[model samples]
Target: MSPKASTRVARGIITFLFIYLATPIVVTMIYSFSTSWVKTILPNGLTLKWYSELVASPEFMAVLLRSFSLGLLTTLIAMACFLPVVFYANVYNPQVKSHLRFITVLPFTIPGIILVTGLIQLYAELPIPKIIILVLAISLLSLPLTYQALDNAFIGRDFRAMFEQALVLGDSPFKAFVKVIIPNIRAGVLVAMLLTFTSAFGEYVLTNLLLGGNFETLKIYMYRLMRSNGQASSVLTTIYFIFLAFISLILILIMQHYSAPHKSTKEGAKK
Candidate 1:
C-alpha cells in the first residue's frame, strides 16, 4: 500500500479503537444521569436527584469515608514498607534482587478468593483483630503493583553516580534518596499509589470474605444494593467512578508538573 493510504488506515484504526474503548464508559456516564429506572434503551429524562440522594445518605457517606481511609492507609503503608527494601535490593543486592522479584509476585499467582480464605483462617488462629488482618491482606495484595512501578523506576538509575555525587557533597545515602531519587521517581510513585488505592477501593472479594458483613466498604455496599436495582446503588457507583476519575486526573497533573522540572534541568545542563 502507498504511504498515504497506510497512514489513513492507521488513523482510522486508532480512532476506531478509542471509540470502542470509550463506548461503555460513555454509556455508563449517561446512565448515571438517567432519571428513569428500568429503561429499555435510555432514560427519557436526566436529573440530579439521584446524585443528591446519594450524597445525603449517611450509609454511603460512611462507606465512602471508610474506603478512602483504607485505600490511603494501604498506599502509605505499601510505600513506607516496600520502598527502602526494594531500593536496597536493586542498588545493593545483585544476586537476591531477582529472587525478591519472584517472592513479591508470588501472591499474584494465587486466586484472590483462596488468598482471602487463607488469610481468614490464619487470622482466626492469631490474636490480631479482623480489621487489621483485612488491611494487611489488602496491602499484601497491593505490593506487587507498587513493586513493579518502583522497580521500573529504579531500573536505568545511576545509583553509583548518585552516591558518589552525594558523598562529594557530604550528603548521606538517605539524604540523597530523599533529594534526588525520590524526585526522579515521582511519576512511578504516583502510579503505585493510584494502582494500590484503586485496587484496595474496589476489593470486594477479600474484604467481604474477611469481614463477613461485619464491616462495609463502598464496594460491599454497592454489591449488597445491586440486586435491589435501587437508584441509590447507581448513584453510589457514579460517585465512586467520579472519585476514581478525579484521582487519575490529579495523578496525571502531578506527572506533568513533576516531569517538567527534570526536563528543564536536563536542557539547562545541555546548554
Candidate 2:
C-alpha cells in the first residue's frame, strides 16, 4: 500500500478502537442519569436524581473521605520510601536498579490474597493499628510503579552532576535534593503520586480482606451498592470513571507542560 493509504488505514483502525472502548463508558454514564433504563432501547427519562442522591448521602461522604485518606497516606509513604532510594540507584549506583527490577513482578509473585493472609497472620494480634499495616502494605504494592516513574524521571538528565554541583555549592544533601532534583522531576513525581493514590483509592482486595469491610473505602462501598442498588452503583461507577479521567487529564497536562520547554530548547539548538 502507498504510505498515505497505510496511514489512513491505521487512523481508521484507531478510530474504530477508540469508539469500541468508549461505547460502554458512554452507555454507563447515560444510564447513571437515566430515570429507568430497564427493557428499553433508551432511557425512559433523564434525571440528575441519582447523582444528587449519591452526592447528598452522609455515607457517601464518609466513604469518599476514607478512600481519600488512604490514597493520600499511601502516596506519602510510597514517596518517602522510594524517592531517595530511586535517586541513589539512578544517579550513584545503576547496579542497584538490577536488584530492584524484581519489584516489577511483585504483584504476580505475591498476589493480594496471599499478601493479605500473611499480614493477618503476622499482625492480627499486634498492638498496632491494622490501618497502619494496611497503609504499609498498599505502599509496598505501589513501589514498582513509584520506582519506575521516578527512575524514568532521571533519564536524559545528568543528575549526578547536578547533585554534585549542589553539594559543592554548600547545600546539604537533603536540601540539595529538595531544592534541585525535586523541581526537575516534579512532573514524574506528580505522576507517580497520582498513580499510587489512584491504586490505593480503588483498592478492594487488601482493604476488604484486611479491614474486613469495616473500613468502607470507596471500592468496598461501590461493591455494597452493586449488590443492592444497580442505579446507585452505576452512579458510583460513573463517578469513579470521571475521577480516573480527571487524573489522566492532569497527567497529560503535566507531561505536555514539562515537555514544552525541552522541545523549545531542542528546536533552538537545531536552528
Candidate 3:
C-alpha cells in the first residue's frame, strides 16, 4: 500500500484495539450505575445504590482487608528473603549464582495445578493456617520478579567493593548495606514489592483451592457471589480497577526514577 493508505490502516487498527480493550470497562461502568440494565441497549436508569450497598457490607470490607493483608505480608516476606540472599550470593558466594537461576525458575517450571496438589497433599496432614501456606506458595511465584529487580540493582555496581569501602570508612557490613546499597537500589526494590503485592492481590486459583472460604479474600468472595449480583459486582470491580490503576501509576513513577541514573550515565558516555 502507499504511505497514506498504510497510515490510515495503522490508525484504524489502533482505534479498533482501543475500543476492543475499553469496551468491557465502559459497559461495566454503565452497568454499575444502572438501576436495571438487562435486555437493553442502554441502562434504564442510573443510581448509586449498588455502590452504597457495597460500602455498607461488612463482609465486603472484611474480604477486602484480608486481600490487602495478604498482598502486604507477601511483599514484605519476599523482599526480606530475596534481598539478603541475592546480596550474599552476588558478593560472598559466587558459586551460589548458578544455583540461584534454577531456584528462581522453579515457580515457572511447575504448573500451578501440580504445585497446589503437592502442597495440599503434604500440608493437608500438617496443622497450620492454610493462609500461611497460600502466602508461601504465592511468594514462590513472586521470587523471580524480586530477584531480577535486585539483580538489576547490582548489575553495574560492585557489591563487594561497596561493602568493603564501607568497612574501611568504619561502617559495619550491615550498615553499609542499609546506608549505601539500599539507597542505590531503592527504586528497584519498590518496583519489586509493588509488583508482588499486585500479583498476590489478583491471584485466585491457588487461593480458592487452598484457603477458599476459610480465609475470605476479594478474589474468592467475588468468585462465590459476583454472578448473582451483577450491579454490585461491577461496582466492586470499578473500585478495584481504580485502586490498581493508582498503584500502577506509583510503580511507573518509581520505574522512571530507577532508570534515570542509568540514562544519565549513558548520555554522559555518548558525550
Per residue, candidate 2 scores C-alpha lDDT tens digits across 1-271 of 9999999999999999999999989998899999999898999999999999999999999999999999999999999989988899999999988888886657657989999999889987889899999999999988888888888899998999999999999999999999899988888899999999999999988998899768999999998998998889989999999999999999899888788866647756988
Question: Could you tell me which 10 consecutive residues in candidate 3 have the lowest summed lDDT?
Answer: 258-267
Best-to-worst ranking by lDDT: 2, 3, 1
TM-score for every candidate vs. truth?
Answer: 0.84, 0.91, 0.90
Give candidate 3's error at residue 159 in angstroms. Answer: 3.1
Give candidate 1's error at residue 267 in angstroms. Answer: 12
> What TM-score number comes out for model 3?
0.90
Q: Write the number of the candidate with greater TM-score, choosing between 1 and 2.
A: 2
The TM-score leader among the candidates is 2
Model 1 pairs in collision: none
Clashing pairs in 3: none
Q: Scored by CA lDDT, what does every candidate get?
A: 0.81, 0.91, 0.86
Give the residue spans of candidate 3 off by over 4 A.
93-95, 261-271
lDDT per residue for candidate 1 within 1-271, as digits (tens), equals 9999999999999999999987866776677678874747777889888788777889888988888888988888889988888778877776788887888888789888899778777778879988888888888899898888878777776875786688789888788888877876777888888989988888788888888678899999998877875666666777777888898898788667656746758756988
| Model 2 TM | 0.91
Ranking by TM-score: 2, 3, 1
Clashes of 1: 0
Candidate 1 positional error at 50, Å: 0.5
lDDT of 3 by residue, 144-168 (tens): 8878877777777787888889999
